[model samples]
Target: MSFVRPDIIRPPSEHASYYLPLTSGCSNNSCAFCAFSFTTLGIRDLDDVKREIDAMSLYAKSRMWMAGQPDIVYAILRQWDGKRVFLQDGDALVYPYPRLMEALQYLNAKFPALERIASYATPQDILRRSVQELRDLKKQKLGILYMGVESGDDDVLKKIRKNVSHDQMVEAAKKVKASGILLSVTVILGLGGVAGSEKHALETARILTEMDPDYAGALTLTLIPETELYREWESGRFEMITPFDSLRELKTMVEHSTFSNCFFSSMHASNYFSIRGSMPKDKGKILRQLQALLSRRDPNMLRPEFMRGL
Candidate 1:
């Protein structure tokens, strides 16, 4: 099948970067809570990827268009600032290592000014590579990797079908940091639902401290209609906590997680309330902020349900 370009879903920081697709869908697609579980992974041909880079180069140099390429390629290129490139689909690092290297080389050849290249990487994908292989990619300007840790509780991990264990994820984080790449991970608030909410938050905080990520984000669980998690909720097997409870989970995580200067945030659209701070430095202030919100228990201060997104 021909590669279908995925919609531009990226980290908020990648707003100025080009979206490059090395693969479509995720290699680890068994997660019960993920939308990628519904799609099959597709790896784009190396030559096809090179052609897109070539097209980008042509447009950067002469504002020319390339034939036989999807219009979205040019659309992203037009908005690109030439400073960063974010490889797309769910986990582009799962792309074949040699082919990925070649593609990055081709991209660098075409755009030498690019400061960084990033991708969503699954723990399984990172663990598949040797320390040196990851270092090589980092040398190619692949400076950052966004990993979805989801939850730290082993039971929660098992329930969500994350496949990778807590220890394995910690190993993956160690590998990324060893490779000198900035590792950013996200944990879902209230992922353990009502029965396991507190344990989920505490365990997640433990894992975050263990992972010691350069950046950590907290996302509130938003049930996607067709997903298995959503079905579980509909069938009453999964009981979601209230909005305030979600914030409480976030507060618990923020209060317990220790970091080596990590930038922690709950600023994702899926979050009930947004708070971000540099860990260990702004910890006191951030905790006080969460305490103030939880103390008042005001729904008016939280993000509206209709405004939230996955």
Candidate 2:
């Protein structure tokens, strides 16, 4: 089958990056709350990836355009500063190891000046590769990996079909750190819903401390219409916590999770509020901010429901 190029859905931090598609969809797409759950994974051909790299190189070096190349390539190239490239789709790390390595090698050969390369990787994907393999990729400039650790509570994980256990995710983080790759993980607030909220927050804090990621982000749950979670909500099988309650979970996580110099934030658009700073140092300030907001319980102080996005 021909590879269908995916639309760019990337981390906010990668706004300046060149979107390089090695794979589309996600390897573990069964997460009930995720839009990717309805899609199948697609791996782009190594030759196709190299060709895009070639086109990127040509366009970066001179004002040139390739006739057969997709217009999106040049659209991104026009804005790209040649500093970073973010692999596209959900889990590009799930791209077959040898081919992924070759693609990175090709990218380096074409753009040695590129500073960093990044991708969203599932814990399962990291577990599949050896630390040495990840190290090799890091040497090729794969500097960061964004992982979604949704919830650490076992029940919540099973409910969401995250597949991997908290321990497995901790191991994955260890492997990524051991390989010297900067690990950035994200967890969802209110994933446990009303019934298991406290347990979810505490377990999430525990797991976050265990993983000790270089960066951690907290995102509020925003049910998409077609997702299983949304259906469950409609059927009264799932209960979402209030927005302030979501902030409470965020506060619990921030107050409890210990980090060896980590940047923690709730800056995603899905969040009702944003608080960010280096952990252990700014923990007090962040907590106070949430506390003051929680104390007032002002609806106007929070982001409106209509403004939230997946």
Candidate 3:
């Protein structure tokens, strides 16, 4: 079957990036809370990827539009600055290493002035590659990777079917850092629900400290309809924390997680409130902001459920 290009679902930091796809859906798609659960992974043919690149190059150099190229290509190219390219579809890093290398090589050859390339990578994918392999990709200008740590609490991770252990994620982070690639990881704020919330927050903080990522983000859990977690909530088997409770988890994480100058934030659209700053140095200030909001307990001040998006 021909590959189907997945819709753009990317990290917020990749807003300025040109969306490139080598794969669609996620290789590890069993996470209970994820929208990609049960979706089949699709690998685009190398020639198809090259065709898109060829179209991009032609458009970039001559302002000529290709007849058969997908409109999304030109739609993105119109806004692209031609500096950064973010490989798309959940975890594009899961693309086969040799093909991925060739694609990046072709990308560089076509856009020699490209500043950096990035992709979301599952811990499993990151672990599959050696540090030397990752370094080789870095040499090709693969600058950063966005990893979803989800939750550090083992029980929470197990319940969510995240598949990877906390230790494994830490090791993956280490490998990425060792490869001289900037590591940016995200943890879910309300992942443990009411029952294991505190432990989840503490363990997540511990994991973040161990990883010491260049960037850390906190996203509040937003249940999607048809997802296992959503069904659990509907059946009264799982309990979601309130918005304020999520803020409390955010507070706990910020207070406990030590960082060597990590840029940390709860600025994701799923969050009720946003706080961003350089960790360690800005920890106190961030805590104060959370405290002020938590103390108020004003429902009006928090992002309403109707306004929240995945």
Candidate 4:
């Protein structure tokens, strides 16, 4: 088997997180709006992955030792207060099933109190996994999945070469949820650019309502270097939506969403408004807050254009 190495790995800001780079880059690396194009895609060797996990486990322990704190080890030993792991690179789900399962099991064995293992997966990966397999994987503690359902609009999907259709995404999401895994799906605002913004927003909202993932995140479009999006901007084929317009699109999305268990978050650095709310209950409140912001169009309510790059 081929092997890949990652330059660096770090934990996410939230939770007791650690990033394990199972795959160097994304498997479906054709998204036009993605910066992942700059990175090469390859699967890492299983032995290498085991070594990485062992190293991370040691590192986590060393951190506790260096801190000279009892709380750290206590945190690890506590059942509900276990460390959360975020499998990294771009698409760690691209790892083979047996190897991925073994890695998760190994982590659990090493950590003893691992709360959950999360990873980024494309819709195609979900479609490929059987429901029973996903359930079994979940039983082994692969609890959360972060998928980029960037847009639900078929036109936008085709344009970006996301390689999945609206129907497929809906089905995949349902299966993921049914398997009892928390779904944190990301949707890109302004992917439709000026012309397709409304359609993108409405269609994406429709899908979100239908799929009703556990967590829904929205990211404003940011042009990055060496990305097809940047090239498109240079060639004048792509026109990015203003922060105001993106928020407007976001409102439309929130307004149309019917998902109850969903937690709407845009705390990502890229989005204009870091507005966060829960759904089915806080839906109306969140929508009203968003609408008020839109009506007021307060400059301070949005992230400035200069700070919007990801």
Candidate 5:
């Protein structure tokens, strides 16, 4: 069988020190606003994955040889240029626990000096893994987990068919955190539109504060073609929040938030103004900046539509 290698997938923030992809397709694969199917060009076999790892080893060794230096070799291997590995595709959690463990183990065996590993995981898949199993995986060097919490509004969650609930996300995040793995929860701004925007932001802020994840991300909504959300938008059944309105909602989210020690970011590509600050205390200043921007309504303060991608 032939496996198609995807050229690109959703990547973590540049601020994140390292990112890794462990699997291909998303396990849930039913979010209304998602475009994972469009992006997943192929599925890789287990053996194929091993071969990729082998190729990486050979590549690293060749680079090391070219340098003609033992001291710089470790740096070469550790550099993501040849060192950091991102398990590509949609989500890597689709791999069976044991098989996934085996692949991770093999990677470590090949590159004993690797820095960090990370992947995307749905709440359902993470919940399926026992806490002990997650902890063991952490011990094996899994560093970060990116979870798409989308929105904490239950109605919106049901509408998107996220296949998981707010409570489920909270519990799953707790488990991952308890396992000593860094948890980054994603929230989509403008998810609830102008109608539900306030409630959506408030609920999301409340949930994130409750979960108290290590990192929280906010992304403005951009409707991509072929997804259910796109259809709704095309039909005018869904009213998207304007950039200003979206920013207002983001401000609400920050204002309502109560996270004590969370690093919050809206530095995603789709966002109008990327904001990065710690929560609770910084929330006020962040909201103030956003509100001031909105009050000014300077065209230059907003990101152009062309720059925002789905």
Candidate 6:
């Protein structure tokens, strides 16, 4: 199939980044809670990717528009400060290794001034490459990877169809660290629901401590309609945790996980509350905030249900 450009889903931190699509869906798309589960992965043609890079370079250099290029290209370039590039779709790192390298090489050659390039990567994708392979990409300015590790509890992982185990994710994080590329991972609070929330939170904290990622983010499970998890919720097969319960999970994770200078946050829109601080240093402060909220159990203090989003 001819690769279709995917939508502009990206990390919150990549607000200023230029979206570059190398793939259109995730390699591991069976995760029950994800919207990408409804889509199939598509690898863009390398020549097409290079053409977009060329257009971006042209626009950056002379504010010229390339014929046949989508207007979105120029639209993005208009505000782009020419620093960060974020690969798009569900998992752009799954793009064929050689082509991915070539694309980055071309990107760097065109915009040597780019500070960093980032992409969402699956554990399988990282495991498939050697440290040297990741190093090569880092040398080409692929500075960080965002990975979705929904839950670290093996039972929760299996139920969600994450496929990869806790050990595999930790291993992947290690490989990224070894390659000197920053690792950012996200885990979902309340993924195990009411019955298994405690174990889920504890195991997730264990995994986070083991991975020792440079950045860790906590996202609450916001069931998307038509998704398997949503259907399960509809049928009463899954129990959705309350806002306070979700905060409790977050607190447990924050109190338990140890990090070597990691930035941890629950700043995603899906979350009911946001607390960000350097783990270990800000651990006490973050905990006190969650504890205070838990103490009051004030619905008013939490983000309104209408405002929560995926």
Tens digit per residue, CA lDDT, model 3, 1-310: 9999899999988999999999999999999999989688999999999999999999999999977889999999999999999998899999999999999999999999999999999999999999999999999999999999998899999999999999999999999999999999999988999999999999999999999999999999999999999999999989999889999999999998899989999888899998999978899999999999988899888877777888
Candidate 6: list runs displaced more than 4 Å: none
RMSD in angstroms between candidate 2 and the native structure over all alpha carbons: 0.7
How many clashes would you count in candidate 1? 0
Better of 2 and 5 by lDDT: 2
Better of 1 and 5 by TM-score: 1
List TM-score per model, in order: 0.99, 0.99, 0.98, 0.88, 0.88, 0.99
Q: List, residue by residue over 1-310, the lDDT tens digit for candidate 1.
A: 9888887888888889899999999998988888899989999989999998999999999999999888898888888888999999899999999999999998998888889999999999999999999999999999999999999999999999999999999999999999999999999988999999999999999999999999999998888889899999999999999999998898899888899879999999998888998989999998899899999998899999899988
lDDT of each: 0.93, 0.95, 0.94, 0.80, 0.77, 0.94
Which 10 residues in a row give candidate 3 its minimum summed lDDT?
Answer: 301-310
- The per-candidate count of clashes, in order, stands at 0, 0, 0, 0, 5, 0
Q: TM-score of predicted model 2?
A: 0.99
The window of 10 residues in a row where model 1 has the poorest summed lDDT is 73-82
What tens-digit string does per-residue lDDT give for candidate 4 at 52-162? 566556655663232332343334333323468777767778789998889888888888887778888888898889989899889878998888999999999999888
TM-score of 6: 0.99
Per-residue CA lDDT of model 2 for 1-310, tens digit only, reads 8999998999999999999999999999999999899878999999999988989998988879876898889889889899999998899999999999999999999999999999999999999999999999999999999999998898899999999999999999999999999999999999998999999999999999999999999999999898999999999999999999999999999988999989999999999998999988999999999999999999999988889878
Score candidate 5 by TM-score against the native.
0.88
lDDT of 2 at 172: 99
lDDT score, candidate 2, position 295: 98
Clashes of 2: 0
| Colliding pairs, model 6 | none
In candidate 1, position 26 carries an lDDT of 91
